[model samples]
Target: MSSKSEERREHTCISCGINISGTSAAKFDCPECGTLIYRCSKCRKQSNLYECPDCGFTGP
Candidate 1:
């Protein structure tokens, strides 16, 4: 696989199927499932932005 493909990719949230990056900044508790999921980055450069880097699933 290419280096880009080998790069560390994000993980899909079971609740929302969003990229969580498997990092605390990108993870949060899914009230519907009580499990951590890809959420708004508390310290991200931009707010109100949520999407799956792989699947491109936008937040409702």
Candidate 2:
């Protein structure tokens, strides 16, 4: 089983492609595929576009 740290390492901001392990990132389910999506505070503030890696769904 993977530890919490390992799982955190796997999460990245979909908008910036940056590792969000230690940041106050936002996590949510993709509206199209229900897959988990992460966005860093910076990107979220800028209204950056994010595409769901699983379903190819894009959103602001």
Candidate 3:
């Protein structure tokens, strides 16, 4: 059995607000706070803007 810390948490796309886990999602850290952010391929491909929930940093 996997420990709680080892369990993968569900990630939501910061751009489209869609569930990204188990999909082809891009993962990166918030440039300001190091908070992990996920973006779906659709959004990434379109260069959709995303805001960091942790630091209010917005970018494409």
Candidate 4:
């Protein structure tokens, strides 16, 4: 496999910076800027705040 393809997919939780990919990660787009965001189940259950890197829009 190419280096890019061999690389493990890593998706970090926007709120906690924890690796979420390959797990029960919740993926959604930021309401304001539409930037894709990933959140782990733990963080989602707790309703952690997430800020959009593109627009700085924050919400739980």
Estimate TM-scores for all models.
0.26, 0.81, 0.81, 0.82
Q: Over the stretch 1-60, how does candidate 2's per-residue lDDT look in tens digits?
A: 969776656678999999888789998999998998999999999999998889899999
What stretches of model 2 exceed 4 Å from their correct place?
1-8
Global lDDT of each candidate: 0.50, 0.90, 0.88, 0.86
Tens digits of per-residue lDDT, candidate 3, 8-47, equal 7777899999888789888888988999889999999999
Better of 2 and 3 by lDDT: 2
What are the root-mean-square deviations of the candidates from the true structure over C-alphas? 9.0, 2.2, 2.8, 3.4
Clashes within 3 Å, all models in order:
0, 0, 0, 0
**Per-residue lDDT for 44 in model 1?**
50
List, residue by residue over 25-52, the lDDT tens digit for candidate 4: 8889899888888889998899988888
Candidate 3 TM-score versus the reference: 0.81
Candidate 1 positional error at 56, Å: 16
Q: How many angstroms is residue 19 displaced in model 3 relative to the true structure, after the best TM-score fit?
A: 1.1
